[model samples]
Target: MKKFLKIIAIIVSLLGLHSCSNDLEMATVTKPEDGVFKLMSSADNVTLEKENADSQTAITFHWDKSWYGIDTPTNFTVQIDSIGGDFSEPVVSELIDNEKSYTHAELNYIALKFELDPDVEGQLKVRLKANLKYGVMPVYSDTKVISVTPFSTLNLKYAMPGALYIQGDAVATNWSYPIPDEQTMVQIDDHRFGLILNLVGGKNFAFITSSSGWSDPAYVAPDSTVPAEGGEFIPSGSNTTPAWGGTPMRSPADSGTYKIIIDFVEGTYSVEPEPSIMAVPDELYIIGDATPLGWSTGPSQKFTKVDDFTFAITIALTEGKYDFISALTWSDPAYKAKTGSEPLMGGNFIESGSNTVPAWGGSDITAPAPGTYTITVNFKSGTYVLSL
Candidate 1:
């Protein structure tokens, strides 16, 4: 009887082991079924008010928590694309944390990035993507479509010298850069304005603010001699050129696009004609509190020209603030990143605008640490890189 009982016990133990193994296999083989998920919002159309344009909470998105029957961690990504645009390209793609919402400023910036016309209704498709851990396929919820209108109060203060015009005998038209051309010289600061123009040699030139005619005030040599560096512009009512026999400045002997630097504080200006065949300056430099130069405009670090439109530089940047300029003097034709990110080698190049005015047009580039870095800017491609 004892032997028979031992045999039965062995058989029972083996059968129990088989059943345990089957249970383990079943656990591993389990897969989650598709869950009914959807994205919801109270409002379908949101008109962004300028008052709430700041970095305030703009909108919130709610969705049903997906159930995979397991405690697998999941991630949610919010993607926004223009209407009729497929997921292939989304204007705004961001990962949402525990709180699923975006700020007004954030949305406004995204709208600007999407090139949405201001005050015009634009349609956008928003969708949520849920990713399951441990190799489960990512689940996508139904898209939520919404209409949004964007507005910007970013009124930039035009630096001193509100407007500038270039008129010369060498210029076929009386007004160069044309009337209302973006090239018109504007104040960069209280003291200076800078202009880059194609100047013809041996031609008489003069500075004027009004494009109506030569009746406006003009800048002439202090001694009434051409090519003099120091001069003062007469008041608007004065006919220095048209009535008082004022002298129109003389152009250099060689013809080319020249970078003209004017200092209102010192009442002085300098002309640097093109050094090569290119019309624009071949190099650009950085100046501000962040640079070692400390706005002294010196021995400014130089940018390397990779191509006609691409320029780069590498140097140790401090922890404060900085800006880029075409020359040493504080003036217009300065540049700032366009407030975004671009893929660089190890990191991203903060994007910037070309030849921004007022020196403070874009956010300052901050150094994550005091170290040497390479900064590259491409105007044609509209990209910039600051990498260590």
Candidate 2:
């Protein structure tokens, strides 16, 4: 009988141990509550007003609920920085009484200011993050970019004398001009300089000049007077005639100071078209500053060839006035002659007028008084034409 009692006691002890293990497992399965918080206002971006000497813009932040499901969070903090990174312990705000929202009244009253380095010239990243109790990790939102621009100054001056002009054929001349301390005089890129000269009714001449030193004597003029090294002269346009002016004759030995001279004869002058036009094929495509259409080169909206020497395109421009010129893509000779490099057509976007022709090339185009505009392609050319 004693042996039977021992077996029963062992079974009861075993059952009690199994029940305790099941209770511990149930407690482990239960999850802890999550911390609650949310932004009171819904705004993606904000631009604060400029602060005055004594007043600043104010902002408020409200939490969705108390931290850790508690009715009140006694200790709260706020921080700010111009850059986002793994910052050290940040400057914390003072702890306030138990509340769901905090008012930044101090910021509203004091002037808010920041300074940027002189070398930076792009958007700066600013970030704000927060921390709370209840095993919650720090929460962050999108960063903001603040534009920073550097300062600079520019100075301009004419590098050559204003009165300088071309004279005798192949004659040399010298010019004295002031230059900025920071800038240096270099050869003109296109071997040409801006010149203002009055051509006689029947006179033509060719001139040559260089940026190197000038050692040879200046070429002579048709008149008997000696030609000055830095002065103007008239050309006789005759190869056989000897130079009568006192101007010095140039030899192979002279290579220094650059020279330019003009020849005068009875003739009319004509402006030459760009050489690109000659190379364009009979069928060519043009666009850009040379065309009436504003600059755009996408596949959906591009210049299309209409014929051997014509093409068309369409664009939506702002209501205000604008300017454009003809520009070619790849080089082609045949069509270039008809199109030429000059601006082919131009016009205004008006509310109502000559619907066929909007405006003249180099003229202003008015926009609709105030409404959606349906701009049509209405430009034509003798050698070349364009359509919508």
Candidate 3:
């Protein structure tokens, strides 16, 4: 009995020792040191453009995880405050993951509201720390400075005639000027003006003037010179002339001295109108197995009147056979390729045979292939006949 009791005591001691060893191993399991954090702030100065009264600026912070030997960061934290101040109680604290760079535009409105305070000026420091569990210590990025300026001032000087005029048509006169930077507004009289200059790296300025007030103007970096003619505004290519119109400025009749001020503020570009796509009558609509049978009624199909009878349709097509028919009025005698009881052969219609249709119909008539096809009509006192 004494020996059995001694044996049981030994077994209990061994079990306790094994359990303690397991506990120690679990506690020593450390997180990977590969986790690291970095922060980058764009733009040393933040110019809250005139239009951004709400004080919402798009600030971007970028960081890299490769430094820490991690595939990607699981999460990140952004702390922003007045320079050199602790961000533990920051004016703005943002938590983000899935992106190495975070844009302030996506922050909560309350955070933005706090940052927009007028008192928030000077070097705004943005601290970014990434959280990754692996090879190295949590890497921190260098402090970024964002100068919070209320407004940005842009100086406009006439490149050609040293003298600048507050009012009158600068476009009509020979004036050379630099393109306005985006977010800069040029004001003439009570109205705002836009740039119309068409030289390489050059911009033209035009502003609307009224008896009372003027509109605010903004300068956009000139991508290229404005074309001379054609109501359409496009970059000047080798063959096109540069012209400016469509945005008409009211002529100031009374000769009065006015001041022209150019202000630069952050602003958004106005949406441009979509190009028109219209089909002409007496024109053929073609489609094949790849195209819908009733493609004429499709949203992509449209007819626009270039003249009384001439119409145009712009379409994008893939390589395939297409079937088409003319949509001319049945009673129109000028375009009739066939008569009752007499089947009109393909030779009876006109074919251009690979020539692009002229902008307007006149003596120009293109021949067609050996099949029934529709002939384009001209409503302006002229008849268009299609002959093969």
* Residue pairs whose backbone atoms clash in candidate 1: 337-352, 338-351, 338-352
lDDT string, candidate 1, 1-388, tens digits = 9999999999999999999998876476333343356778756787787775565677888775543455556677777876776876575444535337777777776775566766788877888777765535677778888888877534422223456666667554645444544235534333556555667777776666666555345664444553533345433335343554456676677777565656655666666642222234556887777777877566547777876556778677777767677776754545544342322222212223343233344455555567666776654323355654
Collision count for each candidate, in order: 3, 32, 46
Best by TM-score: 1
lDDT of 2 by residue, 183-299 (tens): 111121111122212222222233223223221222233343322322333322233245333332221222222222222221111121111111122332333333334443334
Which segments of model 3 are wrong by more than 4 Å?
Answer: 1-38, 50-57, 91-121, 133-139, 150-388
Each model's lDDT: 0.59, 0.30, 0.35
lDDT by residue (tens digit), candidate 3, 272-327? 11111112344444333323333233434433445533543443333333323354
Who wins the lDDT comparison? 1
lDDT of 3 at 282: 47
Error of 2 at 49 (Å): 3.6
**Which 10-residue span in candidate 1 carries the lowest summed lDDT?**
342-351
**Which segments of candidate 2 are over 4 A away from where they belong?**
1-36, 39-44, 51-53, 89-91, 97-388
